[model samples]
Target: MPDAAPVLIAGCGDVGMRLAALLQVHGQRVLCLRRNVAALAPGLPGFAADLADAASLRALPRGIRRVVFLPAPLAREAVAYRTVYLAGLANLLDALDEPALQRCVLVTSSAVYGEHAGAWVDEDTPPAPLGFNGAILLAAEALLLARLGESRGVVLRLAGLYGPGRTQLLDDLRNGTARVPRDPPFYANRIQVDDAAAALAHLLALPDAASVYLGVDDTPLPLHELYAALAQQLRAPAPGIGPPPPGIGNKRLRNARLRASGWAPRWPDTRAGYAALRVDPA
Candidate 1:
């Protein structure tokens, strides 16, 4: 493989770390920017910068050819979601012009297609966000798309991500707080962290300009099944089955667009993904 361009990962969280590792393995100079630089790999170059402060963003090293923008934890809260989303993105964009940056990949979520009750959501699916989080994500998508026309950029709408240090269900199970709603037929999509990282690497290597892709596995497992698998894996007592609360049922997402892009997932289903996590929890 040819040497990759200098890449900057804005958020060195679980996904960010995986991306950074892969970029480094591919022979790219990676610079990670995050509030907690200690969380990143010790050998990787990282910059401590507050996502909310535009001035701090200016400190990002210039001559960055590629960038992966991962939303900070601040985007999770309902109230502060939009402010941080818009402000953080705008601040980053203001820090550098497109001519100086070769390409950018914005990591977004499937929440933009909020509450997909039995409906299959894909890249072309119109966003119908329900709650504040989804609304903010949708707004962020719009802003990113608007800027995409001006630069070589793409948006990756990822499914529920799981892998090393990010076992969402496993974490709940270990804490003895795994909640399994009684509602049957309620399923959700997921993708392993390694798969997500590979998808990003594939996009970065492609010669294409701008595109929107859904990063998800082939199977969308039922919520109860997911919890039960975790319980079994951990040898812990399974949560009592109960009816799923209103508006919190199965949501399936389609990744036909991404699959069509010549990138195949190593973990095509959640069962395989979860099975791989059966070893040490750490």
Candidate 2:
């Protein structure tokens, strides 16, 4: 496939937009599909189409060589979690009929590993998702992997992501209202948005079959320690720490698979990423 063929990004959220920008900078054509075109940054080709609508998606621009499936946001109060998640993915997979499509990268979450407490979990680990969100992600992974043939498909299980315009933990710390789970210091992993984008870029450039890679930093930090450091950087009050609520616990994801693929994260840990955020306040 030519390097200039448009890469289709299904959902143009924070990470999706950043990935599109990086691909655009590298002179790759980026076609972002979303419910709202206004959400995409200017100058990037965007199509205002709903993934829920199969017909509209089937008509995507031609010569799209790569597809990045970012999960669409669901209603917090929606009663049909499985239906929405499966239906959206099914529609997209059905819509693509282009024989030239060579690569597909589906963004799954590390939540599939469930609450790891302090243990390191990798791609090979058996998925034991805890809640509905985790269940849905695992289901999605199965769906994509089942349909993925020799088209160089990939499943990227990303940890908690934090970057510009998408900073919940940092924001909470800066406001001096950050809360930690009551359980003992449990480990959590994260990837800087830019590093995540870089990993995707690297995977796309590779000539291979389907693979499952974990997207996480080298070091996993306790949730409290990360917030504490953030509070110090912001010069705000040391935020109050509490235990994770009943259902929500800590998780540590291993990135050895991706690292072994010759992709090293610029920010290998939450502390480093958080510090950089303070310096530039992203």
Q: Give the C-alpha lDDT of model 2.
A: 0.76
lDDT of all the models against the reference? 0.75, 0.76
Error of 2 at 13 (Å): 1.6
Task: Give the TM-score comparing model 1 with the true structure, all chains together.
Answer: 0.88
- Give TM per candidate: 0.88, 0.90
Best by lDDT: 2
The residue pairs found clashing in candidate 2 are: 180-242, 181-242, 181-243, 181-244, 182-242, 182-243, 182-244
Cα deviation at 130, candidate 1, in Å, is 1.3
lDDT by residue (tens digit), candidate 2, 99-163: 67678888878767666667768878888877777778788877877777543568888887877
What digit string (tens of lDDT, one per residue) describes model 1 on residues 1-282? 544446878877878888888878768788888888887877788889877788988867667777788866563577567656777877887886656766778887877775666677787777776666667777776787677553367888888888877756676677887676655457768899999988887777667644678999998777777677767767777876766544333578888878877889999988777778764344
**Global local distance difference test of model 1:** 0.75
List candidate 1 segments past 4 Å from native: 1-5, 174-177, 236-238, 243-249, 279-282
